[model samples]
Target chain A: MPDHPFLLEAKGLSRHFGNNIAVNDVSFSIKQGEVLGFLGPNGAGKSTTMKMLSGNLAPDKGQILINGIDLLDKPAEAKACIGYLPETPPLYKEQTVSEFLRFCAKLNNIPKKQRITAVDNAIERCGLSDVSQRLIGHLSKGFQQRVGIAQAIIHEPAVVILDEPTSGLDPIQIREIRQLIREIANQHSVILSTHILPEVDMLCDRVQIISEGQLLFIDTIETLHEYMQSSALLLRFDTEISVQQLNAIDHILQSERLADNTYRVTFAPQHDPTQAILSKSLVEQWQLTMLMPEKHSMEDVFMKILREER
Target chain B: MLTISQNELQRLFLSPLAWIILALSQLLLAYLFLTHMDYFNALQGKMSAIPGAPGVTELIAMPLLSNTGMICLLITPLLTMRTIAEERRNENLPLLISAPISIYKIVIGKFIGTLSFFLCLIVMTLLMVMSITLGSSLDWLQVLSGTLGLVLLVASFSVIGIYLSSLFKQPTVAAISSFALLFLLWIIDWASTNAAEFTLLSWLSLLRHFQPMVQGQMNSQDVAYFLIIIFAFLLLTIRRLDRERLD
Candidate 1:
């Protein structure tokens, strides 16, 4: 973890509805000005966790600290620093976009003199100025989602928690919203929950994967990639080389032919297969063009972690 | 609280449901008044033949108040059915729940908005009272008392409707349940033969207490009964909203 102060901390948080546990003993922390991607499949307790953090659903088992304040013990103080947008945008259909934001500002206790300016700032930030006067029911899904973000940030809280912020948007809208999230993250710590793997890879600095109410991993995306690294070497040769000749190298555990004259070889991590191949090539008077190590993608790491947990 | 009230009032007026209710109630009230005028004219012609007959004006006001009270019972469910039920149905309750405003303020704000519309309907019916005064020696005091009683009775029914609205998640279910509950209360009073032993039911019956007021007698006990019913149901609504949010 960086030296930055932690903005959010959860310890042994759990929620049970009757006999079934919705979120079981999940714990993680996010730091100041950090973007933490909360990754989980459907019904995997992502929304339940977000709800608890936002004060919408109280936890049945442990403690959540927002800016070092316990949420359960001092709910208003804790919530004063957090903003939340649930999976479904809770909007009054009859209310115009501007009207809704104004009400949210009042609900958030924005000072009377600053309420209009704050609402205007949010409208511009969320790109909702065009449809500000339109009734929420008349707007499309994308515009409605923008309105949701507008309400969440109208209060200018310290942390913004969004559950599936880009769930239903098209590619263009997704990109726009991602940019908006990035911009918002500049000023507030964002806890974004999403099922899209690529979104986490593209936007979040760190990710927490939760499955069946259990937190499987919490690490930076870079470390997660390193954790999934495979012990393989990719080689490209200008001249043709027989598979049998490449197999002659002692460190070559397995070899697969690629296009033209290239080959990929898998070996043990400490083996340094490139030196072995180069020495064999020098001995055989054959040319070796390129030799490089292969790195794993986040998708590979995610699948590997999930598979291991299962 | 003021913002919540203004927002609620704006939403209440913007919907077609509110207008549909007001227009239908006004039409019903006009029909009842025209019918009452005709009946009173016929009764006045026969007043000399009947021994110690009450004046047509006095006879007309009681049924008019009863009819108007019954009409309010029908109209209130329509007014309040969507107040809380539609919010939950559309998943919009969180907007109010997460706000700093208390549940009581939200419920009361909505109640006041609906009551204002109901008051407009009462004002429209005052035209009928004006017509009665132009043709006959009608007691203006009786008219004021009757209108006051009708307003209180309508306000009480609106409270019950709002309370029931908060209990159900679907607008249709809320509307149907409120109508059924109010209809049952109306029938219980209609079927009871003894008014003394059923005094509790009489007090509960909005029509029962409204009768003396429509006849120009302002009974403090009756006024207190209506106020109690209003307070009871509004409190129940607040509690219901709180319980839902907690769960």
Candidate 2:
């Protein structure tokens, strides 16, 4: 509504429960059509932040602007532009999927005439067309989660915030939900909070890493991939190589023998020693069975970021 | 607000609890109505010997309406306990919380939803009263005044039930506390020795104000009392939910 590039922006948000600070001075923004993955561990304040952003929980201090409207000042108007799904899908298990979504459409103040189409669109988008007439209690957990998503997007707000949308689903369901989220990102900006790290890489255009209520990292997924690009190499030789021989290469930080004739070689980020190692191995007659740069799994980068924060 | 009220009412009917409460209350009240009618018919000759004797309206309808108050106090908690507490327990509250609506609208919507269901029960009781008009000449003013008193009494009880429901997460706990509080309010005036005193406790008693209207007397003070009680408790419920969001 205003002249802002970000559809949703949270600034210096903080919430406290007694002596515990649940979310501490966090700030970030997401542009339209971008999926901002919120990565965090349990109790890292991801849910708390999501609650504050969606206007469900008011922060002790901070401002949340949805489409440049202040959330605390004009909550109903600002919240009209935002959609939220908490950690547990907030649903009435007694109602059928279409019925629940129609109720949501009413809650969001959609015009009566358009409500049917809005509900139908949400049902179709969430892959819930098959079971729209079934009671939510009778559906599987996966279907219920889809109903949660449907209720969130029923009014087609500018921002859709889903907290742990895929936490308890099986692999197949998880993949299906991810695909659905990817489809949602085509029209609305999405802020998805999940502890699962790979989900961020798979669906997010940008990522924010939070740990202990602190924003440790906020960057594009490419930069996160850069973090995953470890400066380590794995090598296997026909004959066992001495640690001293591996250390002799320039820019090699450290080297460790993992098994017979196998070594994990750490090197500096600016200098890769693969070419040096190959020439040296040839001169020393160390028959190279394998040579490849070691890549850090998402878990490694996640843990490394968390460890550095501590 | 209408949207929330409609959804809440639909959800209430969807559960077996609402239908059970409706059927059980009608059964008990109908039985009470028949017994009172039989007693009035048996005493008809003895009452005619006395000058200006009470008729079916005085003998049957007033007492039946008074007893309806007691039934309402007992059953309203059961009906209203699930209004907010179950939503909180099942984590369904966030859907309402995150919507683009004020907390006041939500509280009032829940109150209206529960009040509408109770209105149906009162209507059923009025139907029973209307049946007596077929056999004898009935005092329409007395019956109407009694119905007004019953409506006000049930309305206040519903407000209390909804307020307690918002305060607790477990529906059973909410139901129990609501019954305890309503019963205390219902009989609090008994502690007063004389009606002439008109102490604060008696003024606050729910039954004290409801009694005059049941006797075919309509006073502005009695109606104001019930209205004030409903407003105050609804305000308390709105405040509770606002505080819950901050918490």
Candidate 3:
């Protein structure tokens, strides 16, 4: 947490549909100017949590405080501080871009004299000036997604919530949207929920991963990066080698034969095993071909957590 | 609420569906009005010979305004079908409910937006009959009362349309259901013949209350009845949307 007071604080939020639990005891707080990425697989309570925070769905078991105001107790006053975009952008195809965005701004309670300026600011920020007069239905998918983002930030709400903002965009569009999210995160606390792991890695400052309606982890991206720096090295050789023989090399912790001529060499974190392995390979004339540390992607981290929980 | 209504009304005007319904209803009502005039012209001598004869007010504007009411009953579903149902079908109602605006504002805004379009339709039909004043003596009180009765009657009808639109996600289903419901309310009086049934069915029938007002009788009870129905349906729509937002 920073010195700035939290802009959004949700405590013990849970929602149930009939007998099924959709979100279970999720508590998280977002500070000003922080981009909190909500990571989850399908049906992992990401959307449920987002809905609760956005004041669209009331939580069954908990309270949400927006900018020090209780959301349930004072919804109208509190909700004025939020801008939300659902998984599907809510758009009226009959109206053009300017008309729809102006409606959104009005819905958010923008004042009369300031509405034009607010709408224009949003249009410029979302790169929609060219298509501002075009019907949203006629725009490409990328532009539709931009319209969704533009509406979310149109009123310049203090907290912005977006669910799967880039679920179905091309690579360039995804990058552009990521850049837009970064730009919005400068002044607003954004809670972005998406299943795409790279989206979190690219744009999020803090990450909260949920699985089976339960939050499994919440940590900084730097901390997540630390988990990716594995000490195990992947080695390939021209000749086959026994696990015990590979382990006998100095500074080696363990050895496993991965393929016909490849071995996974694990060394202690502080050990410089590459030099020792190379010298030993030359002495023993074991043709050492490739030597590199194993890189751990987010997929590996996600799979490891799921496996651990199971 | 004003913002939502403006946007909703703008969209309503942009689409040709409401325009088509308005045009068709106006043509049919104008035809009905002209035929009523022809019948009154043919019976002018007999009506003049009778004591306290039926003038153009009783002969033309009454029937024209009543016919306008029937037109409204027949076409209100088409007018209000897309109010909220289209938003749901397009998966955009979430945007509406999620806005800082309350469910009551959204429901009321939709009701007023759709009603304004239909109100314009009603006014245009009334304007067509205003030409009657150019050639003959007309009872202005009866005309005013009839117009008031039709406005209240169709406003109630729009309440039902908006409520049914909120209930279903498909606009066609909403339209059909609204017509079915309004038609049932229209003919509920026929479901009974006994005094006990008649007393209750007459009160429940949507058109029963409008006939008295259109006859130039400004009964407070009838006015209260229409107002109460409007309030009930408006409350029902607000509650339905409240529950839907949580779902």
Best by TM-score: 2
DockQ-derived CAPRI band for the predicted complex in model 1 = acceptable
Per-chain TM-score of chain A in candidate 2 equals 0.93
Query: How would you order the candidates by DockQ, starting with the best?
Result: 2, 3, 1
Higher-ranked by DockQ: 1 or 3? 3
Model 1: lDDT equals: 0.83
- The TM-score of predicted model 1 comes to 0.88
Q: DockQ, per-model, please?
A: 0.46, 0.83, 0.71
Docking class of 3: medium
What is the lDDT ranking, best to worst?
2, 3, 1
The TM-score of chain B in candidate 1 is: 0.90
User: What TM-score does model 2 achieve against the real structure?
Assistant: 0.95
For candidate 1, lDDT tens digit of each residue in B1-247?
6666667777877888777877887788778777877877777777878887876457676567678788878877877887888878887776666554566888988888778887877777776666666667777787788888889888888898999999988888898899888877766677667876555566567667877888888999989988998999999999887665335
Residue pairs with clashing backbones, model 2:
none
Estimated TM-score per prediction?
A: 0.88, 0.95, 0.94
- Model 1 alpha-carbon miss at residue A308, Å: 3.1
Model 1 chain A weakest lDDT span, ten residues long: A1-10
- Which residue runs does candidate 2 get wrong by more than 4 Å? A238-254, A275-288, B195-197
lDDT of 1 at B201: 62
